[model samples]
Target: MLHHLSIRNIVLIEALDLDFAPGLGVLTGETGAGKSILLDALGLILGMRADSGLVRAGEAAASVTASFEMGALAPDVAETLTDAGVEVEPGEPLIIRRQLKADGGSKAYINDAPVGVALLRELAPFLVEIHGQHDDRGLVNPRGHRALLDRYARVDSTAIEAAWKKWRLAEERLERQRAIIAKAAEDRDLLIAHLEELVALAPQPGEEEELAGERATMQKGERLAGDLSSVQQVFIGSDSPLAELRVAARRLDRIAGEHPLLEEVLAALDRAMIEADDAEDKLNRALDALAFDPLALDRVETRLFELRAAARKHACAVEDLPQKAADMRIALNAIEGGEAEVAALEQAAAEAGRVWRALAEAARAARTEAAGRLDAAVKGELAPLKLDAARFRTAVTPLEQGQWGAGGMDRVEFMIATNPGADFAPLAKIASGGELSRFILALKVALAEEGGAATMIFDEIDRGVGGAVAQAIGERLARLAGVGGGANGGQLLAVTHSPQVAARGTQHYFIAKSSDGIVTRTGVVQLDGAGRQEEIARMLSGAEITPEARAQADRLLEGV
Candidate 1:
């Protein structure tokens, strides 16, 4: 419930602080006494669009703060706040603040943490629901009718929603498979031809680099064979160095005993002769192994060209061709698997559809049955509000397949006939302003415990009706406020002029405007015992409080 509201520097309200209790709180004042300003300030806290005109004349900004006690909040309220990252401390107040600057900019806060205006708007529905002459969003909107009926009937539509999601998922998978199969069919012949080409070529892994290396070696051999033969000639053929060195070493060996220097020279020459023979043998081996084949080179080059061309055609590296072939084979395999997979998915989808239909049909039946009871209950409330001839009915019509939703396959609307023999139409269109208020009151009383919002604010809902009708509205509002009814219930705040209505409030606030020499301001006073009697008397009579009016006020209080 709304625990407190504080307004500063708003239009006609320089400063005000209000502490609210959990029951009917009536704000009564004369016409143009700034009763609407209070509601406007409250609207600002609820994340309504801000206007610079709301600021006070001398101030640069206006601010409104609303605090709520959420210890006994509805489950939806707790879930919404938790999802939004707004922590609701147990046994503490949740505060929302809005500030409107004179420069046409605004800011919002939740528990003093800055947040966007959207979050505040999202959080508002769980805290308060305001109904005025033209506000029909909660109880009267046709789009909300089905859900309200379900809430009234205590029907859980979770199973139907879950089934619908499963059916949708199955349908999505089936469609995806069908699309894949269509694409595979379009590309089938091309894939098969490519596969056949790859299989015939039979390119081995790393074969491209191997062929290039072998080709390089063959080209180098063509240049090296003549060079190796010339080296053989120098070492052992035609040059005659080894023969001359052998003769020189034998002459030195014969003279080594005669001269020690001759012996050292002979040893060196012997070592040189041995190295020359080993070099000649290596040259002979090179000459034997340096043969190059032109046909082999041509074959290697041709194979390399084929592999490079295939790589370009496939838009991949030469080494990646094998993996590409494997991928295509997998794609071909999927084409074969698609038919069976699609059939299975279709079966699953059919089963999901059957489950959803069963759940939705049960939900529809529950709504139809609840609608009858709801219409009867609302009709029973209408006569006492002075609409005895008016007929109210909850219309539950089956929706088209295309329009069916997770909610159900039904479109629920509240229809009414304002007069006898009149065709039933939308309740909003048929009811006059006064008739609409009574109808909404009756509906609210019927759905007292359904909506999750803890506080309901009515901006003069009892307007233009007086006597027993006004008294009836007052009683219903009190009942909604849970006055003398229960320990824990919703709160009702009504801005009213009816003395009966004002007198019936568990708490009373009087809004009035006062002017100093230069400026005007609005203030509210929580009326006490004598103050309450005097204010009710003032509401009964004109500017003066007459004895008769005071007596009438006493009677109204006594009746309450």
Candidate 2:
């Protein structure tokens, strides 16, 4: 519920502050008494587009702030606030502020945190609904009509959600099939080219790495072979010096005991012979390692070249060639899978089409039933508003396939006939300003709880209406505030000029203009008992309030 509103530097309003309460609070004033300005201030905070022209003549900026107590907010609102990282204390006011600068830019804030204009717009429907002759032309909007039908039909949200789920499931299956179909339609030339490359390469996982290792070995083989042969000749080759060392060591071993000094020399010679023998054994191993046939080297080189050529052809590294081959295989497989997927998706799409048709039929049927009741209810209100001769009807038209959308396959619009002989036409095309207001009132009364918002505002709801019709409007507005026998159980604020409308309010405020010639300003004054009577009387008798009008105002307010 909106708890407080503050305006600063707006056109004709230098500064203003207003505190609103539950039930219906009416703002009453004469023509050009700044009543509309007060509502405009409220609209600014509700995310309406800001114009620099709205700023006071001498001010650099204009701002409006609206405070709402969201302690008992709807679940969606709570989640929204939670996601925004704003704490909503049980009794705390959620303050929204919008400011426009003379520099032609505007800013908005929620709970004192700067926010984008998008968020402010998103929050608008949840906070208030301002209905006036010119502003609330939405009563005739086809989408609004469809929404009302759904609301009055008592269509369970769960059922609608389930229907959407069914539609989505079918849609998903169809999309999957379409993607498959597209894949299968690829030119055969492309597939053949890809397949031929993979087949020619005949690559396997890890093959490139193996060939690389073999190629490296072949590249270094020439130098290694020479080194190994030289080493082997020195140690283990039959015509090598190592053989002479062995014979020398044997002679030394045999003569070691001939002399004491010769013993040390013989022992050293024997050790040398042993070391030389070990070196010969190692050289034999080296000779074996370098003993590759020419054909083997040729084969390794050929395989490495093949692998390198394939890598170049595929634009990949030697090691990545194998993986690329696998990828190609997958693409080829997709060529086959595409046809099968297309069939599946085609079936799914057909099923989705069937499901949507059935659900839409059911929704349309529900709307048809609801439309009759809706038309009857609104028509009932017309007589009291002095439109007994008027005819009201609801028109529902189904889509011709191309018009399918998230909403459904049908369009609903409220049609009206102002006179008995006239055929019912779109309300917007036929109804006068006053008629539109009353029609909206009837709809609001019928669908009060259907919308998810926790608050409602009716700006000048009683405009271009007076007498008993004005009384009916007041009664309905009061009903919205739970002032009538039935409890709408939401806070409502109305700006009005009708005495009956003003009398229906649990809270009343008088908005008037105050000027010092050089400076004109707007002010809102909360009225007490006598003040309220005077205002209501003024509404009834204009600037020259008469005794009879005052008496009538007192009686009207007393009844309320």
Candidate 3:
């Protein structure tokens, strides 16, 4: 329930603060006394569109703050706040503030934490509901009718929603599988051809680098073989150096026994001969090592070229060919077995659809039964609120299968005939402004037990009706505020002109405008007993309170 409202620099309301109590509270004043301005101020905090024109002249900005004592926050409301990262303790006052700049900029806050205006709007339906003659929300909007009916019926849609989601997921999965299989079927021949080529090539990891190395070595060997052969010819033909050294060493050995010098010479000649023989033997081994078949080099080069060409064709490294071949084989296998998988998915989707359809049908039945009771209940309230001539109905029409949704297959709306012989029409289009407000009030009274915002504000709901009808409206407002045995013990505030309605308020606030020659300002004062009496008298007597008017005001208050 709204505990307090603070307004500053908003139109005529330069500054105003008012505290509210439970039950039905009425705001009353002479016409043009800024009651609407006050409601506009409240609207700021309620997430209504901001208007720079609402800012007071010469003021930089206008702001409104509302404090609500949330005894137990609704789950949806709590989730919205939590999701927005605005923490509010249970049973704490949820403060919402909005600032509107004269330049058409605005900001919103919840619990002192900055938030988007959309978040405020999201939380508005759970925090407060403003019902006016021109209101496009709450009961007047047909878009929300289904949810309202479900709420009225106390029908939990969890199972239905879950089934619908499961069905949709299954359908999506089936579609995806079908698309994959279709695309694969289109490429089946290509896949088989690619797999065949890769299998024939039989590429192996590291084979490309090994073959390239062997080819490089063989080419070098071919280049060096001629040079090595020339050196081998020199060593084999022996330019006679080794033979001459061997003969000189034998002669030196024969004279070595006669002289030490001759023995040294023989040792040196023998060492030179031994070195020459070892060099020739090493050259022959080198020639043998360089000998490789020319065909072998061609084979290695061919293999290397084949591996590189295959890599280019497949747009991968040679090492990846093996894995690619394996993947192609798997794709072919899936193609061969895809029909069975598709059949399984189709069966699953069909089963999900069957479950969803059953739940949807049950939901439709429940709404139909609830609509009957709702029509009767609203009709029962119509006669009391001066809508006795109007006939009310709840139309629960079934939607087509293609239009069905998680909410079920029924489209729910509130319809009214307005006259005995008239055809039923949508509630919004069938009534005059005054009649429309009455219809909404009757609907609200009927659905009081169904949870809505914690507070409800009726903007001049008792607009064109008076006397017994106004009194009845007042009584119903009181009942809605839980004054006696009303279904919901929530807060109800009304901007009213009827003294009977004013008298019904458990708390009264009087809005008045005063001019200081050049500047006009609006202010609100919480009324005492005497204050309320005089105000109601002024409402009855039109600016002059007569003694009889005062007496009548006393009677009205006494009646309440």
Query: lDDT score, residue 161, model 2?
Result: 52
lDDT, candidate 1, residue 213?
92
Compose the digit string of candidate 1's lDDT tens values, residues 1-560. Answer: 89999999999999999999988999999899999899899988877899899999879999999988878656776787777777777778889999999989999988888878888777777888888878766666788788788888877877777888999999999999899888888999999898877777778899999999989888888989777766665666434767778878888788898988888898899788788878777766665555589999899999999888888888998898888888778778879888999899999999999999998988888998999899988988898888999999899999899998888799999888989999999877888767877788898787765764788888887788889989988888888788876544678899998998998898999898999879888999999988999999998997988999999999999988
lDDT of 2: 0.76
Model 3 root-mean-square deviation: 7.2
Which candidate order results from sorting by lDDT in descending order? 3, 1, 2
lDDT of each: 0.85, 0.76, 0.87
Tens digit of per-residue lDDT, candidate 2, span 422-488: 9988877777766776676776776665664556666666667688888888888888788866656
Candidate 3 segments exceeding 4 Å error: 198-327
Which structure among the candidates has the greatest lDDT? Answer: 3
User: Residue 506 of candidate 2: its Cα lDDT?
Assistant: 89
Error of 3 at 449 (Å): 4.1
Among all windows of 10 consecutive residues in model 2, the one with the lowest summed lDDT is 180-189
The C-alpha local distance difference test score for the whole of candidate 3 amounts to 0.87
For every model shown, what is its TM-score relative to the native structure? 0.79, 0.78, 0.80
Error of 3 at 93 (Å): 3.2
